[model samples]
Target: MLAIETKQLSKSFWKNNVVKQIDLQVEKGEILGFLGRNGAGKSTFINMLTGILPPSSGSYALLGVQGPNNAVKKEIGVMPDYSSLYGSMTALKHLRYLSEVSGKKVSQSRAMDVLQLVGLEAHANKKAGKFSFGMKKKLAIAQAIVHDPQLIFLDEPTSGLDAESVIQIHRLIQRLHQQGKTIFMTSHNLDEVEKICSRIAIMKDGKIRRVGTMDELRAYYQSTITVTMKHAPIAATDLATLEPWLKQVGAQLEMEASHFTIQVESEQKIAEIIRALGSYKIDIYRVDVDEPSLEEIFLEE
Candidate 1:
């Protein structure tokens, strides 16, 4: 079954089209990383999906249930970018209350277990008002998963978190995946997305630009690549034997004497470049292809 699906989903305020015709589909057990620049209507689109705000036009379905409906809400969990907490309430209290609201009633021990899962067990009795920014973010995540919903929407789960906290949250995300949950998350950190997401969908001008795995996204933006091969230091004389062979394969040799860079546009050219190098019998040690990272692809024009 599809986890989430949308068609021409859009939102506008006072004639400002925040979200445009966005047709997106996510499969069950898929981890989709949603990407967009600031002010690109990413939040608006997420809110619409999570039922916080209604779309001005179009429609969406969550787990085969159509909306505007409340039944789907129980099947989904949402960790919004910002959440309000009662500073006076303890972390344990927050979890229990959210669980109850989600139609599940658990003992205090269960609540503490959830807190421990988020690494906040030590501060269970501490009031959320006094919690650090990272702590509150953790609490938000804990609440979202307390019910163990089938599908979860996490917006910048690592925002406001320190390096250590980021690592901890990543592990938590992995744990949820192990339980076979579908996760749709948003993040500006391409490295983080690359590490955890099964697929990615990028938004630009309030519309989905592309959606695919790392290789698919790379292929969409694939252009000339700068191949940097590191081997035993090359003398100027090495170029004579190597350059001719490269030329034969329509590959160009460039840069300093110790190394060479090949400008590759197609995958076939890259293969030919490697073939030429292998045949030359040079003392090759390493070859590095300088391709665009996920971040670069998101920012591409």
Candidate 2:
């Protein structure tokens, strides 16, 4: 079952199009990482999906129910990029109020349960205004899930969190997935998304440039393999000796003080490059091939 679906969804403000004809889908129990550079319309799209902002033109469905429907809204949860909790209210009160507004008949125990789930139970009685940014983020997340919504939208949930807090949030998200909730989250941190997301959509210029599993994105981009070799310093005169072998294999070589780095098209070509270098009597002390990181793929686009 698709927990979320959008078709030709778009939004504009003051004649400036922020989101342009986006189509996306998230299946039940799947975590879809919505990725983009800032101003790539990730937040705008989330706002539209959650009905926090009305789309200028388009349509969406949440859990098989069409958008702008109050029935659908009751089953959807959203943790925005900004904290929406009441500042003067205690964490416990804030959650209880939200649960009440959700019409779910949540008890104090249920509020504490979500607080514990988010690791904020120790500070439950503290006012939200006194909470640190990370703690407040946790509170907002706790409130979002208090109603046990089937689908959750988290916008930059790990942003501004310490390493431990980030891990806690990641684990909480994973646990939600285990409970069969669909998650759609936006983040500029590709590494974090890469670790937790089952699939990802890369957005650029207000349109989705690519959407697929990480392996699919990597394969589609054809990541470059960098091979580093430790060798004795080469004389200016001897540099020419390595040029022919490098040229024959179409490898780009960069020389450092005592090492050479060769970037090739793929890992399979490394053996041939090694053989070519061996034929020239170049002592190979070490060879390492580095795969491309997510940053590399984004920049290449």
Candidate 3:
């Protein structure tokens, strides 16, 4: 069974329907990236799925247990963007507390191991309230995984973190994946999501508008491939000479000095232009083919 399944699930606050009917599935061991703008109901959807609130309509299942099931809840970990830490408790104490609350209590040494995993070993004895925002975020992460849950939800996991902290969190996420844990994450850091997530789902105006892998989403929007070539400068006459070949490949060309940006109909159609260029001994030094960047795709979505 899938780690998560939703069928037309929705949530509303009085008159405003923040979360519209959403049908999404997260498979086992898959890192799914969920994205949306500020008011797109991403948080509301997550809140309902995590049992913080009930859906206004429809239903969902987490690890095959429908709706709010305490048994399944114990098997899932959540690192919400807005979580509070106890002012009087040390980081290690927080982890130990959660471990017990989840009914999977471990030794103090194991809690220390978790603190180390989140790069909070030095602050294990420090009060959570005295830690920096980034350090507190790390503490929250440690609490989430202290019980060794099979599925994790990370909401804006690195939002206010420093470069080093962000890198550490990314590495920790990799370890979780290696342990065969399914992760459902939401983040505005498009570059990070592009690097780590196996598949993506985009929500818009309270509904999921698109879902696919990077390449699949690229193709979903009829986006063309842009190939930038570095070669010797081309004269207008040379470009005109290549017009027939370019037309055959259905490419729109832009030239600037030694660089040529060929916007092809698609990736499959770019090969013909490259073959013709090679046949002309254009001496191609480098070729970089790019689809629209994740930010560009998100804005367009």
Candidate 4:
């Protein structure tokens, strides 16, 4: 089943089109990484999906129910990019109030369970206003999932977390996914999305520029292979011998002490270069090939 679907979804404010025609879908039990640069309409699209902002034109459905319908509202949870907890209330109290508002009839035990799940149980009695930024973010996420919604939308869930807290949050998200929950999250952190998302939609200028698995995107952006080799230090005379071989393969080489970095079109060229180097009886210690990161691909666009 599709957990979420949109067709020609769009939104406008005043005379500006914030979100242009966008078509997207998320399958049940899948993590869809909604990626884009700032002002690229990621948040606007997310808002439309959650019904926080009505689409100017187009259609959408959440968990099989058409939009502007409240039937599936209870089945979806949303954690926005910004924290939205009541500062004056204690963490426990805030969760209780939200539970009542959600009409979930949750008990203190349930609230505590969620707090612990988010690693905030120790601060349950502390006023939310006194909590640190990371703690507040955790509290917000806990509140979003207290009802055990079938699908969850998390926008920059790790935005303010410390390194340890970020790892903890990633693990928690993975556990939720394991339990058959579908997650649609927006993030500017490419590394985080690469680690957690099954598929990604890259947006730019209010439109989806590309959508695919990480491997697929990487293949699309594949450039020359970067090969770094650790070899014995070279002299002016030895360098002349390497120059002819480098010219033969049309490879560019950079040298620093005992290291040589070569850029070649493919692995076959690397093998040829290695063979040429071997003919010179030069010893090679290591060879490393660097591939383009998702950030590289996004920036290139």
Candidate 5:
């Protein structure tokens, strides 16, 4: 069964339609990244799925159970905002309380394990009011997974974190994915999404504008393929041999002292270009293929 499935799901606030008819499916064991600009209704979409807000229309299912019902809530975890943390409660107390509140109480040992998983074990006794913003974020994650839910929703999991903390959270996320937990996460960090997510969905003005793997997204744009080759400088006379070969293939080459780059319509031309270079006795050191980045693709239109 799909981890998440939505058909024509929508939400409206007053006369303003916030989340349009969005049809999205997230396979079990997949890490799907949801990307969008500010006020893209991402939070509202998540809130509706997590049972915070009711959708204005349409339907969604989580893990084969039609929800946002109690059964589905039990099988899923939502990362809460740091502000929701009780100022008087210690980190350990927080997890234990949340676990009980979710109707899936865990032992103190398991609670500590969750704390350690988020690198907050040392501060287990520290009250939430004394925790740093990053620490609270960690606690928030710890709260999300303490009950071992099958699916998780993380909103900007690494936002406002230090470099080390960000890396820690990335590793934690990868570890969770490795454990076969389906993750539906939203982030403005395109590079992080590109590196970590299996597929991505982009939202704009309450509508899903695009959704696919990186390669699929690139193909949607029909991006130009840039091939960069690092090689020993070719003799001027060898240009006579290579230039015509490039033109014959409808490729444009820009030469430098020791490296050259070529732009082609498709990736199929790369192999032929390499063979032609080898035939011309060009000593190739390295070759790099370039495509449009997620940032570049997100910015278009």
Candidate 6:
């Protein structure tokens, strides 16, 4: 079953469509990263799915239930880009209040556990008014998962945290995934998303532009493969003799002493080049195939 599904879901304000006909589905147990520039309608799309704003057209289902209702709300947790916290209340109380209002009241000990997971247990009694910006972010994350919801939506979960705090959050996310929870998050930290997300979705102009695993996206954007080989030195005359073989494989070779670089059309040609080099009695010390990174793929038009 899909953890979340949408069919031509859209939202608009009069003449401007903020989210334009987005058809997307997120399978269960996936840490899907949503990426887009500012004013890309990412927030609007999220708000619609969370039931904060009604859609102008189309439909969506959360955990296989149509429409937004108390039952569906109880099964999903949302940590918005900006959450309004009760400044006068302590962190512990904040979780308790939000938990109960969501129809799943957590006990005092359970509240403390959530705080600990986010590295805020020591400040359990500290009022949010006096907490640092990072601390507030932690509390917001804590409240989102206090009820142990099956699905989570974290918007910029580590936007303003220190290195140590980022690591803590990464570990917490992995632990949740181990228990089969579906995570749909949005972040500008491309490196972090590349490291932790199983799949990525790139949105633009209020529509999804690309969505796939990292390798699939790379292949779609990359036109050529680069293969670097370290081998025993060969004479310029001998290297020139291999031009016919290289041409047959649709590859171009550039050599620097014992180091050689070959640009090929596909990975299949790379294997052919390797075998051909072996026939020439060249002792290959190493071979490296360069693949495009997530950032490189995301920047493509």
Tens digit per residue, CA lDDT, model 5, 249-278: 756778788887888887788888888888
Which pairs clash inside model 5? none
Decreasing lDDT order of the candidates: 6, 5, 3, 4, 2, 1
Regions of model 5 farther than 4 Å from truth: none
Q: After superposition, how far is residue 276 of candidate 2 from its true place, in Å?
A: 8.2
What CA root-mean-square deviation does each model show from the true structure?
2.0, 3.4, 1.7, 2.8, 1.6, 1.4
Ten consecutive residues with minimal summed lDDT in candidate 4? 243-252
Instruction: Give the C-alpha miss distance for residue 221 in model 1, angstroms.
Output: 0.6
lDDT digits (tens) for residues 123-184 of candidate 4: 99999989988999999898888888899999889987899988988998999999999999
List candidate 6 segments past 4 Å from native: none
How many residue pairs clash in all the candidates, one count each?
Answer: 1, 0, 0, 0, 0, 0
> Could you estimate the TM-score for every candidate?
0.93, 0.84, 0.94, 0.86, 0.95, 0.96
Task: For candidate 6, list the clashing residue pairs, or say none.
Answer: none
Top-TM-score candidate index:
6
- Indicate the TM-score of model 6: 0.96
| Residue pairs whose backbone atoms clash in candidate 2 | none
Q: What are the lDDT scores of the predictions, listed in order?
A: 0.85, 0.86, 0.87, 0.86, 0.89, 0.90
Worst 10 residues of 6 by lDDT: 243-252
Error of 1 at 7 (Å): 0.9
The lDDT of model 4 is 0.86
Query: Candidate 6's C-alpha lDDT?
Result: 0.90
The prediction achieving the highest lDDT against the true structure is 6
Residue 112 error, candidate 3, Å: 0.5
Model 3, range 127-212, lDDT digits (tens) per residue?
Answer: 99899989989999898898999989998898999999899999999899999999999999999999989899999999999998
Give candidate 5's error at residue 136 in angstroms: 1.0
lDDT tens per residue, model 1, 1-301: 9999999999999899999988999998889999888888888999999988989999999988887678777778889888878899999999888878877766899888889888999999999999998999999998888887899999999988999889998998888888989999999888999999999999888988899999888877976676777766655675677677665554566756567777666668767766766665666667788777997898783
